[model samples]
Target: MTTLLAARSDRPVQFLWGTNVLVEEAALQDIVRDDVRLPEAGPTCEDLAPARFVTNPAALEEVFLAGMNAVARMDGAPPITSVVVRIQGWREGHGIPAAAESSPYVGWCCLFATPAPSTAESGCLSLADPRAGSDLTAMPGLPWGRQVLIRPVPGALAIAPGWLTHSVVPIEHGQQLVMAVATCSR
Candidate 1:
C-alpha cells in the first residue's frame, strides 16, 4: 500500500488536504437556484459557482470543522481558523506553478461533485505531479506549466501534495457543480 507522507515544512512546498464529505446536489442546486444573477465569464454561465460559500456560513463552519478533523487525523496537525472556496471556470489557469519552490506555503484541495457518465465508470479526480521535475520553471502565481484535470466524487475528496500541479476537467455534458476550499494547519 502506498502511504501518504506528512508534508515537511522544510520541503520546497507542500499541502495537506481534506473535505466536508456531504455536499448534496440538492443543496448545491438550492444555492444556484436562489442566486439573483449567475456568475458570468461572458456569454457562458456556470449554473453554480463558488459564491455560495458565504451564503451559508454555518454550513461552511461545519465543513471547516469536519475538514480540520480529517486533516488532523492524517497529518497530526491542528486546524485553521478560516478558508476560502473559489468557483473556478474551465478557462481559468490552475495556480500551481506560481508558488515558488522556496516559498513557505503548503497546498490546497478543490472539492467538487459530478454526475456519472454512461458506458464508463465515474467520479475520478485528475492530477499532474508538481514535483515531477524542476526542469520547467513557473511564473509567480501559476501552478502547473501544463494542465491536470481531476474529477472527484460526491462525498469523496482527494488529499494530494498541495504543490502538485492539478485542475478539474470541464464538466462538459454532466450537471456537475464544483467548489474548492483551501485549508492549512494553524
Candidate 2:
C-alpha cells in the first residue's frame, strides 16, 4: 500500500491509496457482471449492496479490513469494527455528488475497476480541503484550499477520512464501476 497523501499540521487530509492484487480476476469479473445485472435505481447510476450479491464476501471483507488497518495505523486510532460496502455503477454524464460520511463512521475506502476508455476528467475522485475559510485566500507555497484529484485506475484502492468532503467527476464517455466501503470503530 502507498500513502498517496499524508495529513500534516498545515494540511489535514489523509489519503491512502494502492492497488490490491489479492482479489482474483474472476471475482472482479463477477462483481462487474453482478453490478450490470442489477436494476437501475435512477437516471444516472445503479447502486447495489455488494455484500448481498458478491460471490466471495469474505475476500471482499478482507480487502476492506486491509484498508481499515492502514487507516487506523495512520490516524493512531482504534481498529475499525464495522464496514458497509456498496457497489456503484455510474453512467455517462453522471457522477457521485459531493458528500461526507456522518458520525459513527470514521472514514471511507473505495475500490475501483478498469473503467471503459475515458480521459482523466472522467470519473476522477475529488477530495476537498476540510479547513474552514481556507478557500478565501489563494497564496503561493500553501496547501490551503487545494483540492486533490485521483484518477480511476483498475484495482485501485483509496482510504480517506470521513470528514473530508469528496465527489466524483462525471463519466465523460463510458460507465464507471466502484466498490465503496464505509469504515467505523465501535
Candidate 3:
C-alpha cells in the first residue's frame, strides 16, 4: 500500500511525500533506456515521454491530487487547473541548480534503479528555508537555517510549493531518474 507523509513547518513552506508507489518493471526499463540514449550531459528533460509512459499513471496522479488538496487546505491556494509532467534524468556529477517553479506547485517522483547511498546526501532533494534572513541566526528549536533533505528512493514522490527553493544533490555514482510534475492554477 502507498503512504503519504507531510513535512509541515511554522513557516509557509511545506512538503508532501509519497512512498511505496508501484511502477511496472517494463516502464522503468523503458525510461532508463531512453534516458541513456539521450546525449545531454546535464539533467535532460527533452524528448522524454509523457506521464502515460508510466505503466501505472494513477499512482502518480494520486500523489498530485494529494499535493493539490494539501495546498488548498493549508495555504488556501487556488485549485490547480493544469499540470505539466516530464521525465528527468541526471547522470553522475549532474544535478539541478537551485530554482523555484513558476507554477503554483511542483511534484517529483524518484525512479532510480537503487536508493541513493546515505553518505554525503547523494542524490537527495534539498529544500532551502523560504524565509529571508533566517540563515543569519543559529538557534535551537528553529526550523529555518537548516536545509531539508529528501533521500532518493525508487518510487518515492515529493510535492512542494512552487515558491520553495529546491535543488538536487549530485549523485556520486549511478544515474538518478525522476518524474517531475508542475501544476498551474490558471
By TM-score, the better pick of 2 and 3 is: 3
Poorest lDDT segment (10 consecutive residues) of candidate 2: 18-27
Better-scoring candidate (lDDT), 2 or 3: 3
List candidate 2 stretches off by more than 4 Å.
1-42, 49-53, 103-115, 133-145
lDDT of 2 at 78: 78
RMSD to native, candidate 2? 7.5
lDDT of 1 by residue, 1-186 (tens): 122345678864334222112222223322322432323343222324445533654454455445555655555555555544444332222122223222111222333433454413232344554443333335322234433334444334344434444444433444343444444434
Model 3 segments beyond 4 Å from truth?
1-47, 51-53, 118-120, 134-136, 139-143
lDDT at 144 for candidate 3? 47
Comparison by TM-score, 1 against 3, better one: 3
What is the Å distance of residue 10 in model 2 from its true position? 21
TM-score of 3: 0.64
Candidates in order have lDDT scores of 0.38, 0.54, 0.55
Candidate 2 local distance difference test against the native: 0.54
Candidate 3 structure quality by residue, lDDT tens digits, 40-124: 3655333356443465454455556566656655665566655555666555675778888887777776665343455658777
Candidate numbers sorted by lDDT from highest down? 3, 2, 1
Instruction: List where candidate 1 sits over 4 angstroms from the true fold.
Output: 1-55, 88-124, 128-154, 173-176
